[model samples]
Target: MDLRQLQYLVAVAEEGSVRRAARRLYMAQPPLSQALLRLERDLGVELFTRTSRGVILTDAGRELVGRARDILHQVEDARSAVQATAPDDSATLRIGAVAGPLSAGELTRPILEAFRALHPDVTVRLRDTSFADQVDLVASGVIDVALVRCPVVHDDVDVIPIAAEPRALFVRSTHELASEQTLSVDDVIEYPMLGLDAPEWFSSFWQLDPERGHSLVDTQLPPVSTVQGIQLALAAAPLVVTGCATMARFAPSPLIRAIELPDASPSIIGVAYRRGDTRPVVRSFLEAAASAAAENIALLPNATSSV
Candidate 1:
């Protein structure tokens, strides 16, 4: 009935028990149960079904939960919007980036510096999430901007190309390709190739296949979930993966080498956001990214061969 009650319902739904939700919400189980009972009575419907496993949402509860989450998010967005328009230093920009190249510290440093210089009051919060999640985050108003690989299929979002960078074969220092300055895709494919676990956007660069026997690598690995994983894989095994030239520039290990993949197309990195956002902070950041992209373009190697 009220935001507090709706909050309680959401908490119970997430925690899956009245006792657990009470613990989380800093209330007694009895009060939380009474609140749920009142909510159900006021709505004239049973929201949850009791079961041995846990509390499960009824059909109406399922629909109500979705709407309640939306309403809460909208309220949060309104609060953020008000804060966003305050003095420059009070503004916040939530940035979503896939955890390399653009998301890494080195590449973001200059842009963040420029952003701070331009709008010193604005606080920038960066999130390193998956490219697929970034799209939805932007569309849902969860993040102000997302810097990610191109070929994003979401039509509800607007994308601005930030840079086109070379795709290189990353390998451990002991790997045969480590000493080489350039590599053909065919040459690197001989070793067990470590690849990004992606469906289309990333897979297309390597010309991967869902159908059996059509992939270049003997094994397909999910994207390195952590930066340490990326470093370890490159140090221990021959990881023939594609990365932005900027990412390789920032990695801690000299053990890993970025060899030019002659047959792989360069990855196009860009900024994505909701189509209707007209905020000045968002506009300023986008401009800074565009400027940085222009200055950095010549740093990438040319890919002469096609995939």
Candidate 2:
């Protein structure tokens, strides 16, 4: 289907109602509904199941929705890059690395400084964003590349997984569980949980089960968006925060402890770039990353952060 049709499909899927999607797209409801029907007919599959509550994506719709987001994000990036870049534009690479293990430790730290040393002439712009969600930043060309916590999830971006480290539970050192080097998910979940914003598949990374779905919440915890925020949170409340190896680095203070989760899903730390991107800088960054992971060499210079 054409981009217009794909856009309409995504809108309906996201908003869950034709009328709402129409409002979002600034279009009439009838045409949006007609467009949805046309798309389903052309694809030869039912995309959504209508119910009293709203619309739910069928299995096929769920699949197509991800594909649609990828296509649209790529198109938007292409348009932005072309329009924003002039022939004489300065050589700059915008990179986003989330705040945590992805940016703090062995793999990404060396690679960041290494990439800069290798391409000294290029201006590198760095931003610290929330975990995993940086895939959207890369696909949209808001940044040229990213180092982020895993399950990149978006098909339009490519991830080079550097390390598979177990998730950890962070708590105040004074907390009872702090002395334990490791803890079970059930034990960790019993405390008030501080959650990070991540994809649905990432709920487990937060020590939350899909079926359990934040059942451990004593009070709905405020959103902790960064490592600094999590640190601030520890001083304020007895909340259990879950993260990967980077969390360990943040735990040197007497205020916090990093407890291992051997049974938790192995947190995938990686570099992400737009799918099919082959610019020399991007390639160099990837090459550096592969070498870092292969050699397992680490130099602990922290990532440089910019707005």
Candidate 3:
């Protein structure tokens, strides 16, 4: 019925639990519950169905939550637009990037340069984050935009597909698979796999072990948190790491060998930002990213070979 009520509804929908939503909003549970009940009464529809785990949105709830987010984002954008008139308002654009192969200079630098060329007055800040944290960071307003790998699942964020890079398997040169020119997902899974500390959906796409239903937590090798950690694990053990071919080509170690996986799906690179973010600078950056991606893709090798 009102912005406050809409906020409550959206929060509950996102958190999927009244208690958690109330905690996030720094409000009492009783008032939040009362508010939702009043909203359901006014709308004459049950917004959520309570379950043992948490709550699930009904059809009406889903529709309302989608519009509510758009409205809230518009309100924030209106406030920001008015505030932009003040002389002291800073012109800094904060960007979050997942620390991995695609975050390398070869892919990111051109986009940065293109954005800078267009918006000379704006100062750009880059924050290095994990794949799991990128969507949350954008939704919470910690960053204006993010460059990440798919599949990102969040209703409050919008992802734009940029490019798809071929997948490859990284193994120690001493490993048996290292000498092989190409491999299949079945072949790579036999060795101890090096897993990254990333979100399940994000990591699953790169692992290509869905047929066996393998999980990174079940990996024999210890999980790594960064690209450097992955590199170290590869050099120290015969563990296999799977990722984009572009990343393997960038590896510094001669001891590491990257073998293509012809049967595996390519890793997708995408740009994401908060849904309904209508800022001019944000729009400009996205355009620049698109242009940069097109240019970069042209330079990429057509087929993945030994690296």
lDDT by residue (1-307, candidate 2, tens digit) is 9876887788888898876875444334555677788999999999999888879999999999999999988886886476445454337888888773455366665676777788899898888777546667898878888877765545466677665666788888888888998787767656777766555434344645432443454345566666777777786777776777566764465678888877665566677887667567777887776666655533432222210
For model 3, give the RMSD to the true fold. Answer: 9.5
Worst 10 residues of 1 by lDDT: 204-213
TM-score of 2: 0.64
Q: What's each prediction's TM-score?
A: 0.57, 0.64, 0.67
lDDT of candidate 3 over 50-116, digit per residue (tens): 8988889999999999999899888777756764674542388998887733553256777788899
Name the regions of candidate 2 deviating beyond 4 angstroms: 1-90, 100-104, 198-204, 211-215, 297-307
Best candidate per TM-score, number?
A: 3
RMSD to native, candidate 2: 9.7
State how far residue 214 of model 2 sits from its true place (Å).
5.3
Model 1: what TM-score? 0.57
**Clash-forming residue pairs, model 3:** none
Off by over 4 Å in 1: 1-90, 100-107, 130-132, 189-191, 206-213, 217-223, 234-239, 295-307
Query: What's the lDDT for candidate 1?
Result: 0.65
Question: Candidate 3 at 245: error in angstroms?
Answer: 1.2
Candidate 2: lDDT of 54?
77
